[model samples]
Target: MRVLLRAVKQIYRQPLCNAASRKRSIASSSEGSGLLQPRHEKLIFCSTAELFQELGGNVEVRTEFISEEEESAFMKELEQGLRKKRYEFDHWDDAIHGYRETERDRWGAMCTGVLERLRTVAFPKGSTLLGPVHVLDLDKAGYIKPHIDSVKFCGSTIAGLSLLSDSIMRLVKEDDAAQWLDLLLPRRSLYILRDQARYEFTHEILRDEDSVFDGERVPRQRRISVICRNLPS
Candidate 1:
């Protein structure tokens, strides 16, 4: 009986040991991926204070969204298990958004660092885990019209981790003509659009095969964005 118990313990330990080993491997591999390196000649690091000071509104940016190795592994897991799985839509009277429950154990474990980082940022009080992280998939022609987020129950911050593809997020002022500011959000990017950017402007992702900027056409790719925000009260 003692031998059998020892054997069971060994089996359990094997998985834990393997998980640790895999994490080490992932960390090492991420050091080599270009994801950690800045993409452009000028790197943009936006903090809440800087956003308010410069834009006269709240917005922040973190260049490294997730390690490429981690993203590749997660994508593999998603493609194997979560791909083509349709999730329910959270619907209001007129607006609609897709929702999916992330693999909580994995997501929580992986995103702990991200959440910790956010805690240091300026966020509203009474914030709680909004829901399971959701993968918001937008097709070639799919678009979300301008609207403010629902912050009645939770804090006003909405964090998105871009995945799978590249896209643009446009913020339009609420003035007579509704002027716009266009931001190009790349894959594996973290975007925090809140405060005035959230309430005073309408944000949208246009439906198009390509986006044109300065006479250059940027091709669109299928996009999956992971969103984390507080639940509505």
Candidate 2:
């Protein structure tokens, strides 16, 4: 009960509206109904086509996608759930602690506007958004193995949001021995993978203290990622 009250308090913190408190997975009746929601200040991102060109086709990343206040609310939701339910599956090889499939409507209900915005930016219009969306909770020591996403079950494009901390995602060609690109996935960044990048290259999180980006080693932080996908057409 106290946790929920705390969440309610955070939910009303101003300057950033529509910031739903993610506390112990308890949402207000209005949030549950997706009605009469507060308006959120829209975040504007300047697009540069050449950057995507340099990165590759079907890959887009928007940094600073959410503000600090919103981040706090979202974190409160995840952290409380993590504490109480502790519903996490461990993966030793990948250096991952918790991996689980979650329902989009249940988990996504807290911030409907943000999820809608993600769909508009990440998916083609009129495409059926498929679930079970995944939530990845990682501690400081956590990392993931390099592997290509399966197209058999989950087809085409994959979109995800990085929360809590910065991430360094590495990629390598499946059939090649040479090292590939290392990307700095900043906290609050939204990353999308499709086409060549999805089918061709494999990505992972390494078990290193810091990773290089443009010759500089950048440290990683504990993070929670919300991943959503578009079904194969």
Candidate 3:
């Protein structure tokens, strides 16, 4: 058996608390839906003050960062066609959509709303600048192969908010596959990758595997990921 690292052991050592579960209600597909609205589902996070993990060297996890209402509302907007039509990128296996600040028409305003939420409430301490928000839609079989974000285009820190389902993120060295780590990312959680993680390691998710977390076998579910890069310095 692979020896579990300190970060992995520390995370499992903490008592697992039930996260508030509130499933988002999918609105009927409308060709022309306005801004995304909040549906207000109850959400919960671990009872601990904060959950942190050092897996893959330089990544930190904040399990259940956004509240139930916040997550539900965000999804409502996304599924209601507020975002640009979903498109496929040859480089990515999953259908991806995003809103950028530069495009000042529709997506720009929508993306700015996301940024405002992160500033006023999400961080709680103070506001942090984030780049364009990209939404990753994964089907039951959807998974991302190992890869790294380009520091040339984005800041060193990358944060992603998980919605809808639980999944595993496997981190591996680009040149050495033997060195790897597994992270259990629960729904509504926010994980940030930076420093070595942003610059050195490549991250991947297995195609719908039973992700093991704290000795429990958690099955993979269809998930949505909203990724935002750090504001450029």
Candidate 4:
């Protein structure tokens, strides 16, 4: 009778332990979910034409960009494949060459989508999609110097897709000495530059092994950027 009484007491105590464990598990899961979410505040989504209109309205500050979960996944896959293939740096070779040499055959698809969208917004009368995409690989301390991408040099909008890692692109107006805009281009994000934003402002990637902002220095990772612009005929 004493043994049976002890067993009953133990069984009654088990529920309290299990409830406490469950509460702790729930708290841990919630914390993890919050961290996975993107923390950037200015991330916005807009249709291509809407973005063009906004750009025209605000010449001093104009940027058309978007981030999609599906696109990001595709880009990650592409990055992994490129890493496996060990793509070389060829300054003379165009974007198509890099795409062909890479393991994943995705560069064409990505460029096509951006070109079609840009044409719809920038050239309503229809225009040919010219190519030889520029595939640029930037290492820990590599960066592109600031300069305007004039239509005289390249006749279409500049569409850049981030394949691996994240970086910042700075836009500075020629006239504004103190004003400049910084954009964090995360992995798989797409940035389209055109009009005055392309012709008047200078865009560049800073050379740093890491980036520090708000007192946090984020380490640099290997980055591959696919740049698409129409060739002037």
Model number with the top TM-score:
2
Looking at model 3, which ten-residue stretch has the lowest summed lDDT? 1-10
lDDT of 3 at 209: 57
Q: Residue 112 of candidate 4: its Cα lDDT?
A: 54
lDDT for 107 in candidate 2 is 46
Of the candidates numbered 2 and 3, which has the greater lDDT value? 2
Candidate 1 lDDT by residue in tens digits, 132-231? 5555665555555555555454356677767766566655555422244445566676677775676555555545543532233446665667666655
What stretches of model 2 exceed 4 Å from their correct place? 1-55, 85-104, 107-110, 208-210
Clashes of 4: 1
Worst ten-residue run, lDDT, model 1? 1-10
lDDT string for model 2 (1-233, tens) is 00000000011011111223112112122112222112111111112223224444455656666666666766765676565545344543333444432333554444566677778878878887676557676666666656665565566777888887766675554554242444556677677777766766676654446454434455766677887777778
> TM-score per candidate, in order?
0.62, 0.68, 0.59, 0.53
lDDT of 3 at 177: 49
User: Model-by-model lDDT, in order?
Assistant: 0.48, 0.54, 0.50, 0.45
RMSD (CA, Å), candidate 1 to true, equals 17.7
Candidate 4 off by > 4 Å: 1-38, 43-125, 209-218, 231-233
Per-model root-mean-square deviation over C-alphas: 17.7, 14.6, 11.5, 21.4
Cα miss at 62, model 2 (Å)?
0.6
- Which pairs of residues clash in candidate 3, taking residues 3 or more apart in a chain or in different chains? 20-44, 36-77, 38-73, 43-68
Of candidates 4 and 1, the better by TM-score = 1
Q: Output the lDDT of residue 59, model 1.
A: 53
